[model samples]
Target: MKHPYTKLLANIIAYAASIILYALNAGGSINGLTILSITLATIASINLVRAITTITERKQQ
Candidate 1:
């Protein structure tokens, strides 16, 4: 989405889901599912940051 808030929300949700996965696998072994969530969360966070930066730059114009 172009809106920064939407990106931020998505990022938050992704992070929350990722954390949940980690919490679920908080024993000893790590699996692909947990790693996937974390990867998704990282991607979402990057997207969020990019959106926020662009949004601010647009506003500054």
Candidate 2:
């Protein structure tokens, strides 16, 4: 029920990279990359939230 540190770290890096890419793309008027980065960040955020919730629920049980 414990959180996986490695997974968390990976997610953190992914999330950070996504944000940076998104911003860079947006600022530079790169439509395709901006959209892709946004999508990736959204997915990563959802997965991270889900993982945290699952770990919390398992601990409570």
Candidate 3:
């Protein structure tokens, strides 16, 4: 089955992977890429929460 938010889920996964990679590469240092990845991850997390809320609302109807 496919979910309406499949694309968003994929994007979130990609963002998470990049965040991990940036952290590993930085080796305890903060850089532009690390900051950017973190920002994106935060945005993606918000989107995911919205998506989950939408799904729950639909189920209640």
Number of the top-ranking candidate, with TM-score as the measure: 1
The residue pairs in collision within model 2 are: none
For residues 8-27, what per-residue lDDT tens digits would candidate 1 score against the true structure? 67767776776866657784
Ranking by TM-score: 1, 2, 3
Best first by lDDT, ranked? 3, 2, 1
Candidate models: Cα lDDT each: 0.72, 0.73, 0.77
Candidate 2 stretches greater than 4 Å from native: 1-30
Alpha carbon lDDT at 53, candidate 1: 77
Provide the clashing-pair count of each candidate structure: 0, 0, 0
Expressed as tens digits, the lDDT of each residue in 1-61 for candidate 2 is 5555658667677877777766876597556767787778777777877788788779879
> Is 2 or 3 the stronger prediction by lDDT?
3
User: Candidate 1 at residue 4, lDDT?
Assistant: 43
Single out the weakest 10-residue window by summed lDDT for candidate 1: 1-10
Winning model by lDDT: 3
Candidate 3 residues lying further than 4 Å off, grouped into runs, are 1-25
